[model samples]
Target: MRRRRTYRLTGGLAAAGLVLLGIPPAAAQEQGGLETQLRFSQRLTQEDGTLSTTTGLGVTLSSRTRTEAFLFSVDSGLEQDFDGSALQQKDPRLILSYSRESLSSALAADFSYRQSDVDALSEDDDISDGVLRLDEGLLKRYSGNLSLQLGRDAPFGGTVDLGYSAKTYSETSDPDLLDEESVNATVALRFDLDPRISAGLRSSFSQTDRDDPGQDTDSASIGGTLDFGVTKTLSTNAYLGYSRVTKSTPGFPEDVQKGLAYTLSFTELRPNGDLSGSLGSDIDEAGRRTTARLDRSLELPSGALRAGVGLSTSEDDDLRPLLSFSYDRGLKRGTFGVKLDQAFSTDSDGEEALNSDFRVTYRQELTPLSSLQAGVVLRDTDFVDDANTDSRKLQLDLVYRHALAEDWNLVGGYSHSISDKSDEDRDHSSKVFIGLEKATRWRF
Candidate 1:
């Protein structure tokens, strides 16, 4: 197991100083607030004919001064399985920010931190080139940004921004899985050219280090952007840049790559919604890649619709297409929604894969204080190079909620899921949960 030294202490201390400086005596005497919630539930799984109990608790604290804001929250849970095994999960988050504006200048700083599960696949995991799987490993991330504007009220005003971010993952059951550490820094300077146009120059550097097998990569890019509004409803942005990347792997040759990068985008803000499109190309350790995307959204009287399409060519010269659509409607006494998505991409190993998902949900108001909701989701994944390694999943859920009081509620839900994999046995699982939830808030 490997770990990186924590770097959040400096930002934390700076935020604390800002809080103290920004809060006046009168503001400090004013009230801050805290909110808390707790729930307990029981679950059943049909695959192994097992029952489990779960409990969750959450709390949030928030405060704001005349020129600063602060928020802290924590969520923790424990699950006890029928087999006598217990799983514990905890997520804690913090946000702190300060902003000040004077006659000629403005300054702002923001910092955030979070610890949670690795919820999705990341590009940095490509070293394994393995099939994507659900990982329950804990992940910690920290980020901060600061911006300063000079001559803010002037037509030729300029703004400078600096940012840093880092992420780490741990607590994996699989010894083969590698822990990751990464840090990123970016700086940008922009000048207002006109009332409807601006220009900016940006530079960024990042490094990612992985343990098992020991790999490290460093990347840097410098770019310029031009933003202009063609009309009140239309606008365009253009960018040109160059990037340099270097990677060192145990078994692979050390390589340094450099290439040009550019992007052009257009956006239309319609009365009802908006439409946008973009095309971009860049080079990195994985080689040169190009991508294009288009998105549109519209609002109806009682509903909303959104759709998007994307296409990209990977370093391996594989072309992948992505499509997605979603629609939601609110009825007099109910709500309905549907979503569909199809995505194609490469796994960590640069192997092409396709993933598709479809979901439908409906909710009906049974009474003024109660509601019934149901949903179904289907997912499919296919590996292009390994057709026999395909997988599919189907899930169904029904939930009922009743308001008991202004701060109390009763919740019950049932869920069932089935998963099928090529050359593997099918797995079926189900759970039923009934719980009373209480929420409380205080100001002091």
Candidate 2:
């Protein structure tokens, strides 16, 4: 079961890569800049009636360069914690891209690399088809893509994209889950029927392979979409497609799955807010899944509010629900915000789980060069199939920042956290830190 869940995590990475390919690259400029920061802090933790203290130092550096046809950026950070359980961490990332345009066509290529914790990444940050998995531990990921478009200015346009991604996980207790890799290719064509209507046809193919478990999956799909404006503020889009998937695993029978998929969506734009809804089915590394979502947002006088609800069902007859809401408001002297989220899904070990989170934060300006911030977070998780596995966590934080110079600052913070589990005693921890930070930026 763990191996199967690991396979699903790799599938999410491929889906995330496809989403990245869909976004247009930023235009190149002639300016460049560099920024760096350094900080020192102390932390304390208590567990099983024992308290421990740790000191840490952190540094971050980032630089960006842009030219006529190329853009590049590098960001890296290092942290060293000195204590009995001392853990040294390094996170480095790089992005490079080149784009060229001609009279009738455009060509672009991009490459990116990053090393970080796997749970820190989220597919919900972009457009996704409900294929998401949660995993913890350190990971290194590399991705590259090439895209070309012909006749972009004409009534008919065509685009071709090819991409590859690989990920390796570390710091895991289970060594059976190793590395994963994938390759993807897509071709799409669009025809402009008129100024307000367009039709598109797209085809995609991908292959995913994993080590340790020795499994390979191949998937292919073709789809068409029609987008039309019904009125100045209203629009409708529809898509229909079919997909086929084949999976091969050692010591098991080969599995083949085929299904029909479709998506119908509507959006309305207003002066103060917007509303959108969609229903679709698509084939992912997990075979096939159907999903529906509704989202709404409103612009208040002082801030904004947003809410969303979603539902999904997989080919294994498992159903899940997702819900989220957030509101932010600005007062004369302070800002306040609150957010709530709930998700029902499978965990990394393929266990059924339900998780809920609630958070609230407030910030106020004490003076022109000083501010105070406070926040609280609460989480509840329950494992449906596992007995005595429910847990709850609560955390509170307060921070004060004061500017001492143009490029230097002082920060003091205090945090308290508590965790309670079924059939176990409660654990508590508290931390207080005062740190000085220096930041500088240079432009060229």
Q: For every model shown, what is its TM-score relative to the native structure?
A: 0.74, 0.71
lDDT per prediction?
0.62, 0.62
Per-residue lDDT value at 98 in model 2: 72
**lDDT, candidate 1, residue 310?**
94
Position 227, candidate 2: lDDT? 92
lDDT of 2 at 361: 80
Which portions of model 2 miss their true places by more than 4 Å? 1-89, 95-111, 117-137, 145-150, 175-177, 318-320, 339-361, 374-398, 415-431
Candidate 1 collision pairs: 129-348, 129-349
lDDT of 1 by residue, 308-378 (tens): 99997766657878778999999899989888777554333234566776778788899999988777767
Tens digit per residue, CA lDDT, model 2, 67-111 = 225545554433333333444434455677777777679888988
How far off is residue 383 in model 2, in Å? 7.8
- Ten-residue region with minimum lDDT total, candidate 2: 3-12
